[model samples]
Target: AGYNHDADTKAGILSACGIEAGPDDAVNLNNLDDWQEFYNAEIAS
Candidate 1:
């Protein structure tokens, strides 16, 4: 099976990492916020 990353999932990940996403922004791995969010979340979980 494949995994999917949705908005809430990204948000939760960001939250867990102590990072915040802008209201008008979406999570993209290319961006620092998103990258850190993903990294921290992955390690945290």
Candidate 2:
């Protein structure tokens, strides 16, 4: 199983972790659909 959160929620989590988003943080949500796609492709391997 996997976890999912909206962009605003994600930003809050990251901020709490002392991580900030920048220009490199841009995500192609229209093409990729959701966070699970990123997790499976980038993190779950």
Candidate 3:
């Protein structure tokens, strides 16, 4: 299920739902601008 969507996609969902994300959050899937970074970090780690 987690693989079904990228982090940015999930982040978009969170944004749509008015969810407030903390700044320290490493995986900013909602942030389409940074999903690639998060994806890369996860696979590498």
Candidate 4:
């Protein structure tokens, strides 16, 4: 099971291109490759 709206996940969404996320940003799920890159950085730090 996974959270559909976790705070950390939302924060990650906001980190995209250093852009601040609005309500609509969290809804964009079209970039698994980019998200995986973000995940890698998150885990490596």
Candidate 5:
């Protein structure tokens, strides 16, 4: 299984937005449920 708090994934999240991650920025993609929520929010935005 993938890591819940992978550094590579965090880096990807930062790159996705084309900006550096702030102090409050965090990626907690721990499971499919988390992915679904994040995907839905991104689509909505």
Candidate 6:
């Protein structure tokens, strides 16, 4: 569902909902790989 939105659009949607994110931050998880990357990064942190 989120595949059609670009990074900027995703960021804008988050911003409108009061979720602030930096330019380099990922705004959506598009697939299992994306979720895995996010999970690994969080675990590392």
Model 1 regions lying over 4 Å from their true place: 1-4, 22-45
Give a tens-digit lDDT track for model 2, residues 1-45: 334557786665455444575222325322233455566679879
List all candidate RMSDs to the true structure: 7.8, 9.7, 11.2, 6.9, 6.6, 8.2
* Candidate number with the higher lDDT (3 or 6): 3
lDDT string for model 4 (1-45, tens) is 332546667666656545666343433533543665776799747
lDDT (CA) per prediction = 0.57, 0.49, 0.51, 0.54, 0.51, 0.50
- Model 6 — TM-score against the truth? 0.35
Q: Lowest lDDT 10-mer window, candidate 4?
A: 24-33
Writing each residue's lDDT as its tens digit, candidate 3 over 1-45 gives 233455675566556545655332434443643554565578647
Listed in order, each prediction's TM-score against the native is 0.37, 0.36, 0.34, 0.33, 0.36, 0.35
Candidate 3 regions with alpha-carbon error over 4 angstroms = 1-4, 21-45
Q: What's the number of clashes in each of the models?
A: 0, 0, 3, 0, 0, 0
lDDT of 6 by residue, 1-45 (tens): 223556776666555444565333334423333555565689746
Model 6 deviation from the true structure expressed as Cα RMSD, one decimal place: 8.2
What clash count does candidate 5 reach? Answer: 0
After superposition, candidate 4 runs with Cα above 4 Å error: 1-4, 24-45
lDDT of 4 at 36: 56
For residues 1-45, what per-residue lDDT tens digits would candidate 1 score against the true structure? 334467786677567556686332343422546567676679757
